[model samples]
Target: MTGNGGGAGPARLGWLDALRGVAALVVVFDHSSATLLADFRRELMPEFNTSRFGIMVFFLVSGYIVPASLERRGCVRTFWIGRVFRVYPLWAVVVATVLGLGLCGVVEIRDFGGQSAVTVAVAHVTMLQELLGTPSLLLVLWTLSYEMAFYLLVVALFTVRLHRRSATIAVTLAVLAAASVAAGAALPASALSDRVGTGPLILVGASVMVVAICCASATSPVLRLFGGVLGALPALVLVPFNGTVPLWEGLVILAVMFLGTAVHRAEHGQGTWWRAAGTAVVVVGCAVGSAYRYGDGELFTRRGWIAAFLAAVLTFGAGLAWRRRQLPLPLTGLGTISYSVYLVHPVLLAVIDGTVGRARRDDPALEAAFFAVLLPLCVLTHRWVEVPGQAWGRRLASGPRRKPVGGPERPLLPFRRPCERTRRWYP
Candidate 1:
């Protein structure tokens, strides 16, 4: 997250860090449990769905901060640059490490379902592989696809001057999510990819994303508008039609994120709290209704999904409520390295799975040991990889920056380089 002003003071942001830290640990447990705490997971997941809880929290946090980051910058080019540097460096390092591990025979790489290397590489490079019908190389990367989609949508709104309508957008997505289920509009995963060949879809999607980003970053107003609209095309086409997740779920994900944005807007006085509260109500109700009507998925129960969703929303609300209080350093520190924890843990678990194999039974000691090892390693990754990349991004973004036409009010969007002032707040 960038910028320290716009009503997001240290107290407000610290709670977000605490939330990230909590979510990271939950997600780490959700993934690692299959190998280290199999029985416990089996017992817990059917009722709680720890994975869903963790990610929903993440999406909410992303919603809360991402739009703020863009609006605070007031420059789409610099915003994109900041996002690329913040996300890609750690991602590239982790992907390369995973591939290296696979090549070394330390872990088995997941099958790409017969996709070509070129196609896979292109898909992953765009960070929309999950929505493009290509499997994510790492299990955790699917969420990044949605994050990228939100970024595009945010840019689109900023360019078109609809950036402040987050509450309306959020409610619309939620209602659509509910309505889709009511209409019984069931679509297979990757339906678009199935109809249009994977290669063709990837080619078109990747090409459009490149053009969209480049044009959105351009100085010409017409080009920016065109690029903004074009950028949203891929996300609009892919999320509902091609994502690996169910249609309702994908829509819900986006809605949840926008709901977070609404919360941020309310906090900053850009919008009213009543509007934010109402959006949250609509979104949560629609999400819960959609899950209920859709019934259970292959891997999760309806009850479990609903429980996790509610828990995530409640967790975020709790953090928001306590936004002013000073949070514990250990929790905030974990939040600082939460991204590293999220990416790095999957690789470590994969190695353990391929090498020694999973624990035959519930092993609390082994689970404890895994965390003991993971935290320190994530800290190192954060220090070496994340910090330097963000520093470079700031340096680059500082050059040749100008505010977008009709962007947020300057007083409401003050500039404060986050990397220099506060600890990193990974979405």
Candidate 2:
């Protein structure tokens, strides 16, 4: 959650960490059970949709923290730099490892459906392959597309001095989601690719992303503003027409994120609690309404969707209610390493599926074994890879060294200075 260089004390959000840990474990269970306990998965998925439940929690947390991260630093360039270091290092490693394993015939890679290697590569690098008519190398990477879009939109609002209007933005997007359903606007997935073609779109998107990040990070106000808009517009445009999910769901995702921001505002005394509460109601109503009207898809059941959505909201609310209380050490520790848990589990699962194949029957013991192996690996990766990468990012974003007048330069810490009461959370 690094957004620019700043002094931030260690995060005090034990409840949030606990919530994240819960969500990460649930997501792991959802995926692992599908492979190791298919009969149980078939029974549960039709009722609960655990994957959706886990991800919605993640989205809400991201919404609550990401904007605050950017505003606290008050520097777009450093924010982008921090994000790059925070996300890309491990992403690069994971992708390379997966690719090497595929090459070594330890696992199979996903086919790109006739797209050129260069186009697919560029799209994945931009982290928008999901929206750009390219398949995700890893299924979970699809969520990162929306996360990246949220980042662009958040920066756009911040640069324009409209970041404080979270409630309005949330309400507006929710209304639009409902309206899209009502109007029967049925756009096919990857509509942008259908028009511009996948190869060209990937090339253009990659170039624009490069320019946008560079310009937004520049010192010049004009460049920064231009870059911000350039970055946000694609997400704004594509979500309606090119997203894999329905247009309404895409809008709901944005709305849900802004709702989280509104809650953050209310908690911080920058906005009234009533306003946040009202916005939440409107967003929830609109999301459920949209789903009802759109009907269920092959992968999504309306009952499951509604249940998961409400459950996620309730879980987040519960966390907020108990935000000040101490949480279990194990829960907080899992939260500390949740990102590694999220990213690494899929790779391990893939390897498991490749080597041993999925269990034909329900195997709770096998599921437990998977967690036993995955948790320790996540701890190691978080300690050695994520921590060091974030530390390096802090040093780079801290800018040019200013020699002390009399004393030696102090050593840099891996953590940022705490912004008042603000704490870091990840997507």
Per-model C-alpha lDDT, please?
0.87, 0.82
RMSD of 2: 5.5
> Which structure among the candidates has the greatest lDDT?
1
lDDT of 1 by residue, 280-341 (tens): 99999999999998983333558888999999999999999988888998997788788899
Per-prediction TM-score, please?
A: 0.92, 0.91
True-structure Cα RMSD, model 1 = 4.9
Q: Candidate 1 at residue 43, lDDT?
A: 88
Tens-place lDDT digits, model 2, residues 358-405: 898998899999999999999998888888898898878876645444
Clashes of each: 0, 7
